[model samples]
Target: MVNKLVFLILSTVILVGNQSFAQKKITLKEAFKDKFLIGVAVNRSQINQSNQEETKLITSQFNALTAENDMKWMYIHPKEDTFNFEQADKLVELAKANDMFVVGHTLVWHSQLAPWVFKTDKGDTINNAELTSRLKKHISTIVEKYKGKIDAWDVVNEALAEDGSYRKSPFYTIGGESFIENAFRFAHTADPEAELYYNDYNLINAEKRDGAIRIINNLKSKNIKIDGVGIQAHWSLEEPTIEEIETAIKMYSETGVKVMFTELDISVLPSPWNSPTADVSVSFENNPTMNPYPNGLPDSVQTQLAKRYAAIFELFNKHADKIGRVTFWGLHDGLSWKNNFPIRGRTDYTLLFDRAMEPKKAFNAVIDTVND
Candidate 1:
């Protein structure tokens, strides 16, 4: 009798455990429902799985995908004389198989560019004319190659500094400020159907916000096909209130172009470039440890980070009609570029999923925040 009772109790617990587990795990399909879309930036390793396990998981959830590396000049043309498309080819294939839209990361940017493009045989800088020809050729080839495959193109990225001045990007030195116009023109010629966008960071500020408006409006006046503006909301634990971001979005929409929140992530750490001694703890309200957990991101800081992301999505949902898409920079915190830049060699938790592929609170918050 005792043995039977014990066995019965254990069986009951097993069934209850299974039911609880099912409730906690939400698939991408269920999470995404029918509201605003959610997407992730993908690297080669994720798509190259032999069983295509990782690729399927992501594609099933996201209707869109962005190439994290291949579109960059470094990977496309590592050597001046050669062009490589092996990785890019694989990515496009995966997107096709999964019936997902692809976003070509960039046509021109300051970072991750090939050294050979800017330097000559004698080590002197190349002139604007030569650079212009190369820029046109590069844009034409890539845009033409993936003409219909990519849904949209970030023609020029982060072209303005925070203060609203034209950022001193390498493109400026090589093709003059007019490089922006030339890039969009060439991309349009190569693939008129694909949407062209002027992507940048810190547009939340009024100064940068106004400057972006002027540029896009000017392009519209000249009949240059600028389809949208990409606001890279790489916010910190503090700063960039919901109203500020919403205003920026509304400002861009006035130019008759779509607004997208691309490259979204919130880093909870010492701001202003990670001075280890800085008092970042003051930024958070709930959890105020000066030096928190892993990578010095305090638990209190994580709570504040979660709230911040939730607020942004609330704004996104409010403006879903005007907002084109919302994209997270990476699949997991382990793969985020934040771990390296602005504050080199620091472990930063700025992604939705933790290093172990487990969904963080931010992930759930976003799902709950989004309505089907």
Candidate 2:
């Protein structure tokens, strides 16, 4: 009798353990379902993976993948003389292990770039020739290192402000407008097989839309080797209507460049910035509290956001032939840039998962749309 009781207890424990494991397990096959590409952004800390849990979550959901680190110039080479390839190397290994289509986030960008890149050893502005050589060397070394591992590269990023003009990023001031074209060309030369891209934000607005079209036209006219355009859909709950986003997509597609929703997230909140400090004095230029976060996204708001995503995704599915990949800015809401930018100090939920890592209503809603 005693032996039998012990056996029963052990059986129960095993059963409960199995159930717990099953709850966390999601295969890449399950995540992809019928979609061509569904991706999530990951951080370096997440890659210290002990199990296949995170990998499974990513691969099951996405076919086309991107590293938010390796592609960025600052991440690849933080210091002038030191080029740290550790983080990016791990991402590549993970992608290869999961059979995922990896994309390099960016080769050149105004944001997240090293400040020293604009200056020389003598602390003066580097000449155009030196700048061009550094650009080529950086692109060639990194892209060539990844070679066949990465599928696409966002060679340039966020070069345009909200208006229909250049943001006048450090790269632009140092290398001129031709810098954009040169980045793409240099990246291509590094890995002739990789598809090169230009990424930007606020594309849904009319002014930015025109700017993107003009840039694409400029590249085409110059016979530049541009492949795709990455629309950084850093959207708010209100403002950019579904029609507006679709319109932007159509407009860019008209340029014969494939579009990818690169950095996507909808800020579902009590107010735009979700901060009490944003009462009124927040200036648009420097104040992070300019936009107030909503009180809290109620169930209805969540559903509406899901519907918007579904509609946009439906557009993507319809035009999958012209689309390359759809990537969420961050995998989990806790790590999103929205947590700190635009609003200085605000605790808000604006991603597919909440802080607890559980899929919110929008997650199921998106899945349902994909299934439908």
Q: Which prediction has the highest lDDT against the true structure?
A: 1
Full-model lDDT, candidate 2: 0.72
lDDT of 2 by residue, 1-372 (tens): 999999999998887665521244443235434555777777766554554555556656666667766557777887777787887888888888877778888788766777778787789988888889888888888899989988888888778866779877677777778888888889878888888888887777788779888888998998888888888877766657767877887888889988888877877544434321211223233333543433454677778777766676677766667676778877777777666665455555667777666677667655544431
Which residue pairs in candidate 1 have backbone atoms (N, alpha carbon, C) closer than 3 angstroms, thus clashing?
287-300, 292-298
In candidate 2, which residue ranges exceed 4 Å CA deviation? 1-35, 50-53, 270-297
Q: Which regions in candidate 1 have their CA more than 4 angstroms from the true location?
A: 1-35, 50-53, 273-291, 295-302
Candidate 1, run of 10 with poorest lDDT: 275-284
Per-residue alpha-carbon lDDT of candidate 1 for residues 1-372, written as tens digits (9 for 90 to 100): 999999999998887665522145665445554544566788879757454645665775676788877778898877877888887788788888877777888888877888888888999988898888888998999899988988899999877766677877767866767888888999999999999999887777888888788779878878889999988777776667778888887888878999987888777755544321111122333232322355445567667777877787778878878887777787777788766555455577888778876767776666666543
Q: Give the Å error, residue 18, model 1.
A: 20
Q: For each candidate, what TM-score against the reference? A: 0.84, 0.82
lDDT of each: 0.76, 0.72
